[model samples]
Target: MASLTCRADCTHPANHRHLRFVWLYFTTVNLSALDLNLLLVFHTVLEEKTVAKAAAKLHVTPPAISNSLSRLRAVIGDPLLVRRGRGLVPTPRAQELAPRVATALRELERAVGDDRTFDPATTRRRFVLACSDNDQIASVPHLAATLASEMPLAQLHIVSIDQLKASDGLAAGIVDAAVVPTAASHADVHAEPLYVDHGVLVLRKGHPIRAPRLSRAQFNSLRYVDTWIVLGRAGVGTKMMDAFLHRHGLVRNVAVIVPGFAAAAMIVATTDLAVGMPMRVAVQLAKHLPLRVAKIPAPAMPIEMQLVWHARTHEDPGAKLFRALVADAFRDKPRR
Candidate 1:
């Protein structure tokens, strides 16, 4: 084979195109002969900046990591990493290749590692979920119990994240999935309707509000407790209720604002303040507290809770299993 080379000043379009082809061909040839696992070692060593640290991370011996580094250097024809006083530093070429190699390794792992059959009873995978306070109240208990019984070894971490940042967190791999009222519009985020719940009025068990319903006048006159979190500005229920009330020329007296739905529920259960929240959430809270659930006087606002995840993990077995578990746990059932 003739040696392929490109001049610095190859101004001709055809020459530029040929140069690109040659570069791609050489890259493919280089990668075809390289061991994919070596890339993992290379990335670890670059990240850790020492063979000993990389060995510890990969659960291998330092000599093995050094040998792998030698092989990588020979194959790539570059001193990928160089030793300084006590640490190693990546060369210019290694620095340039680091991100691409890391990305490729992550993608490869996601493609192969997660495609295996999921065995919930045996696997020790951990799944992180981003949920609101309401989701924590309504869904977490059931989910925790179900997972504890069905997947004893698996772990679950529920985190409170801003709803608006849910998509960003999923995309960035901060959380595996998010339980939100509305789906995000990001192209890389995937959303599924988990369940549809409606807003209801919550008050103390023997408060003034009666069963079945409360008149619009009574509803407007009662003091209200609002749950205001950092992301409360984008609350779907609040926005919808405001719009509905605006249309009817009515507004509830928001006498108090609490940090979360749990707190609001607690306040409403013992005081004259009443809260409007999802029926499922209110019902769950009422089970533990002296609270009563009643129909919202205004037109009903259906809160469609959704499960959102990144497209990158769409096919990941663990992610898929967790998504299925959440959907099954929260799936709406007919009233008996």
Candidate 2:
């Protein structure tokens, strides 16, 4: 085959890379003998760094992926991956081909319109959802119910992720989607509004600070159990609350710093430590825990939840349906 050149006339300058991804293929590959599926396995193995993980992501058996890897190694005439301790590490050749292979696969999938093949009814698959502890308690049941009705045989695997790195998880297929506080726009991810509410101060029902609201002096006297309410700039751990306190020369003392909303809620319910979180979640927690909700003084922490997914799965029909189910499950206006 004659050597092929990359895009010479693509009008969009930014898309020059997609055409370029093919250059590596045409330069060295024989069209008739190359198995695109093998390339998919190759890309997945590289991304996952282990055969078992790649197999799980591709919904295939580990031995099947191992055999595919052997075949890809033979086809590429390189040890594309080699065992290093417990995980596989890509060879330098694979490292060079990694991004190109990913981009090329994406472009090919686009050209081939491969996303239409996803049939939720018949496809028994596992989907991972990333969320905070509160979402796990307050939101996952509804999302799971929706998933069961739509894709009865499918499995839902819920996991916790650092809010700042949730998009990275989506991009890597670590999680199919995330339910989180609204984030700034990113070029590679899509975020849709899930719900909106304000923060409430969570406390034990018979606490000393009995008012429905707090005066600055009362607020300052209270000790707090700080927690990362998972990635929202809305309050407490972020500037939204600290900056508000700064204007009034008020300060909150941290009695404890827990990792999750649930833990913070527990500590606050048993002790006098107060924590601020979304009103909807607070009310839900109050129903089960000895918790009470109060407004976060003035300028309550604004809570805007969003459903996020990476562009890699943007056109996927199953992913689309999953996103819709999540949106439907949690998009209700906060009742209090």
Candidate 3:
């Protein structure tokens, strides 16, 4: 016969149940009775905070969630849910069960998370990642070097995109992950912060507009060489710049709009146009061109770089390990 087991911690109002969780332990119910599935559902419901959302997450109907909550209440002898606003709120008892229940569930999940171990040294899986040209030039080199030396069989494919995602390409697995400015909106997607970058103004060293100190007015008056590539691949830079200009009631005369920073740099070097780029990128371009970098008197508007991945892959052994490696490689190494 199946039986339900109640832990002492479940005595709280929030964790109390109407339907006792049933567990079959070797066809006997002498000392233990617990339904692990119900606990998982309970956890999801608490996290979501609404029965409808929990049902959607679990692929069930709202009534099923209510029934489970009823059972939980009866088993624990407490009104686990009380009406508040348009939803049910957990009481003090429910809050106490949260951490302990979560810890126990995590321990169980870790024990069953993977059936086999991943050996990066021997695996030959190829990873495809989408990122900007700046990331390709500045970021991938170190990753390539490490993978080549350590995981010899692993190959990395870098896909350069002008914008992060115009649609759900990443959701459909068109790309494994991307370095995006903002986290993807999909509930199943996750973004981990990598680094922050700031912008700088660049121009020819001897240009007339290259004042010892370029005021916002002087900076706006000069013809601007705009990079059409759009930082973070979604016209993010254009939007950010436009907002700042609007706030200050300034407008730039865009002399040219090119598809890349390289093109913008080339135009700025040969013409009387100024370009705005991240400090590191400007420094890099300066090495090969006759250009100089100028500090914007305004406080640098910093943008964060994040590693965005699908939620389904978040817990994968290989993906997690590789993500750790990538994060460590890009960890804030301030420019000397």
Q: Write the per-residue lDDT of candidate 2 for residues 1-336, one digit (tens) a residue.
A: 001123333334555575575665645766555666677888888778888887667655576678777867776778989999999998998887876666666655555653468778887888888877777777788788878888999999888756435334664456888987686887567889887877678889899889998888888889998775445333434566667667766677888877778888888889888987777678788888999888655675566778998776788788888888877877774321
For model 1, name the residue pairs that clash. Answer: none
> Could you estimate the TM-score for every candidate?
0.65, 0.64, 0.59
Each candidate's clash count: 0, 0, 19
Give the poorly placed runs of model 3, Cα more than 4 Å off. Answer: 1-115, 161-167, 183-186, 211-213, 230-236, 334-336
Candidate 2, 271: how far from true, in Å? 2.0
Q: Which 10 successive residues of model 3 have the least lDDT summed?
A: 18-27
TM-score, candidate 2, is 0.64
Question: What order do candidates take by TM-score, descending?
Answer: 1, 2, 3
Worst lDDT 10-window in candidate 1:
1-10
Local distance difference test values of all predictions, in order: 0.74, 0.73, 0.67
Q: Which stretches of candidate 1 lie over 4 Å from their true place?
A: 1-115, 163-167, 229-239, 334-336
